[model samples]
Target: MNYVILGAGPAGVTAAETLRSVDSQASITLVGGEPEPPYSRMALPYLIYGKIDEGGTYLRQDPTHYDQQRIRYVTGRCGGIDSRAKELYLSGGEVIPYDKMLIATGANPIMPPIPGAHLEGVETCWTLEDARHILKLAEKGSPVVLVGAGFIGSIILEALYLRGCDITVVELAPRMVARMMDETAGGMLGRWCEAKGVRVLTNTRVTNIESGPEGGPRLSVGLSIGQRAPADLVVMAVGVRSNTGFLVGSGVKTNTGITVDDYLQTTAPDIYAAGDCCEGVDLSTGKPDMLAIQPVAVEHGRIAALNMAGHKHRHRGSLNMNVLDTIGLISSSFGLWQGAQAGQTAKVIDEGGYKYMKLEFEGDKLVGAQCVGMTDHVGMLRGLIQTGFRMGGWKDKLVASPERLREAYISVAQGGAVGGADVAARQHAACRVPWRGERSLAF
Candidate 1:
């Protein structure tokens, strides 16, 4: 069998490896748009902070690992897909045919429509090249004006803070990471950033950017209360959009992202989609969501590959889980919060800075949870939610007594709310244990 996987990021690479494990003789061709090998996108901020060298960020396998695994690596951009011919048209005029194709094109940073955005020193931190350029600018003491206050932007703030770069974040929202956290959690993070000497301007918009004194860039930021601020370098971390332009009119259905069934199969037979370019159904809410996180993408790739390899595997979708490590502060959220209004109830326990736990319950069943600060119990709590634990008469007691949360989980598991087929299904959903018997699934 011949398999061609587009985009050599985590999802594509994992799909290739998984396919190899199932059918050792299957010819695999991995095409990457970027010239460099696959690297950790999460570590880009550290590169800017000078915490790790450029070479250290490359998350590649051994030099000859792909060769030994019989995987062909093609470094080029895929212009389009010819579903009728079962071939991928490359920008370099190469046609790669495939019996099975996996589209893991991932996402690209959304650059807002602002004047002088094309100017020098204004960049997006989406790839290693972007990180390298940002790092160079940071080393030269560039004054940065970040456009968003999302997780990536917050991490960049911390990174530049460590590097002593003058950064002014202008977020249009009222608080940082508003989509990921509640106002209370966002407030805590904002305070943390302020303490770290990072100037976070929330409820503000960047109207224009022009050349500053000494030919540097100056950003004209418009605040909600009608104000402006000027700065040098501009880093746009607005958000990301799925990379599915090349699949247009290729018979692959896409709404926000390439829509895949529970089996990860696209509208076209023998073609599958995963990662940031694919939108999966939310298990908790039963709605389609483009949750562009690394862990979810890795799992999508694995599940897609399993079904592609003739294994009866179904993707149970993803929960809205976010875990962020920013400047020694641990913030994590799973399921719904108090204000989400998902027909779910929540109980919040805020104990100063040491710990914060919020449990979201749908009647007697545990639906979701959010934990900020120290998260020693987050793993277990997340597992209980994913397994569909039912608290029944013990819901209030569990919330009242922190010590009994674990016991409540034990009772729910033993009471068959998370047993039998449900346990097997949960195991399948969490089974990142690569079928190839790999020691770890880091990729």
Candidate 2:
């Protein structure tokens, strides 16, 4: 069997390794667009923070990891695909034939439509090349303008902060991480950054950018609010879309991303899609949804490879989850964190203490949850929501005292027996601040 994977990121790499393990005699070829060895894009920020060197970003430490596994690693740009012929055309004029193909090409960073966006100093921190360029420009105390405060932008903020870059974040949303975090939580994060000496502007957009006059940064950024800031470097972290351009006429369907069935098989026969390039089923909504996180990508890879090897595995779909650490403040959201229709919600807010937790319930089962600073019990939230654990009587108890979540999780998720008396004592020990509840799932 000949297997060809379109990408060498987590998804494609995992698929290749799994294919080799499942069918040892099968020929596997992994193509990566970048020149560097398969490296984790998540580790790019750490590279800028000096926490790791270029070698540290590599996915496989040993040079011969691929060779030992009998996986062919090819570095080339994919020009297009011929689904009818079962061949992949490289821009360099190479055609690779395959019996089974996995499209895990991942995603490309989105560059917003702003004037002078293609200027020299403006870059997107998506690859090794971008990181190298950013490191050179975003030197210590250099003025850096970050155009988005979403997950990627917030992550890049940490590295910029550690590098001593005078950073100013401009987010078009009303709050930071608006997609993952609720208004209150997002506001808290914005305030947290400000407290840490980072200028955060919410509900703002970069209207224009031009060359600076002289003796300063090479660029001047104009804001929607009629403000001008000189920036040595502009990092566009707006967002990303699936890398599905190569599949335009490949007979594979795409809607926001490559549409794949539960088996991760694309519309084309013998062709599968995985990672950020495909829209997998969403567990919470039970619908096709795009989850670009690395965990989902890896999971998609394993399941797709198994099916490709004739194991007949089916992916149940991925739960939307994001855990972000921005400038020492930890925030996370899972499932329909914003709340479901007609869902009962409970929240504990301690802004002065920098702690908050919100639980959304759909008839006694945790459908969504959001938290900041209450990191110890976060895993439990994910567990209860992911497993669809039936809280039963504990639901009301949580509404009364959400801080005693540890007790509830131990009793239900862990299948432990804790008396009600113990629960009361733990509740009292946990927190004294009474939480507020609302029947309406209002914003």
Candidate 3:
């Protein structure tokens, strides 16, 4: 069978490897627009921070890895797709035919329409080339203005901090990470960043940017607050949209992204979609959404590959989740962190300790949760919500003391006809926290 993946990101790479494993003799082609080998955009911040070299961003270490596996890698930008002809068209007029195809083209950063945005000092931290441009300008003590405080912006904020750049974050939302975190949790994160020497201006927008004096800063960033700040560099982390423009006229249905069914199949029978470029089902909402996260993309790739190889696999859908680290502060949200409509919510806030937790429950089952600073046992929130188990009497206890996740998990395990210390031990084993930069242990 001939299999072609129209991306070289995590989803496409994984799909190619999986197809090679499942059907050894099948022809596999992985196409990417970038000239470099398939690399993780997540690592670009680390590259800026000097933690890793450009090669470290690569998905595979060995240059001959793709050749060794017999997976053909093509470097070209996709101009369009001919779904009926089963052909992929590249911008350079090259055509590749495939029996089965997966669209994992991923997303591109959204550059907002602001005056002076096209200035040489303004850049978006989305690609390796962007990182190179940033490295040349974002020097120590340089005044840098970050235009967003979402997940990607927060990460870039930390990297810029490490590089000794004076960063002033301007976010249009009332709080940082507004999409992933609630007001209380987001406020805590903003305070944490401010405490760590980041000048955060929430509910503010970069109204305009312009070339400044030659001897000093090169850019003058005008904010909606009627003030201008001179900046040597400006990084736009506003947001991203799926790269599905090429899918237009291809007979593939798209809404925000390429819409895929539970099987990851597109409108065309042999065409499938995955990763940030596809609108897959969200476990929390039971609706399709463009979840541009790495874990989701990886899983989507594996499942889509299985079904493409004739294994008949159905995706269970990806949970809505975000785990972020701003300087030293850790914040996370799982499932529907934004409280469900008419659902019960439990909040525990400690502004002094830079800690907060909010739990959303529909009846006795955990529907969503958000946490900041208290990272030790929070993995239980994901476990509880994903398992869909009834907490019974433990629900009230959690409402009163949300930190007692270990106890709640144990109670649910024991109530499920399990007994003794064995259940407690398994509960501990099951409730692993998902904090980054720290060992994930049970509470």
Tell me, by lDDT, which candidate is best: 2
Q: Would you estimate the TM-scores of all the predictions? A: 0.89, 0.93, 0.93
lDDT (10s digit) by residue, model 3, range 389-424? 788888899899987877787668444355667776
Point out where model 2 deviates above 4 Å: 418-443
- Which structure is stronger by TM-score: 1 or 3? 3
Estimate every model's Cα lDDT from 0 to 1: 0.77, 0.90, 0.89
Clashing pairs in 3: none
Q: RMSD per prediction, one decimal?
A: 4.6, 6.9, 4.3
Instruction: Please report how far candidate 2 places residue 2 from its true position, in Å.
Output: 0.4
By TM-score, is 1 or 2 better? 2
Separate clash counts for every candidate: 0, 0, 0
Per-residue C-alpha lDDT of model 2 across residues 1-101, encoded as one tens digit per residue: 99999999999999998899889899999999999999999999999999999999998899999999999999999999998889999999999999999
| Model 1 lDDT-worst window of ten | 434-443
TM-score, cand. 1: 0.89
| Candidate order by decreasing lDDT | 2, 3, 1
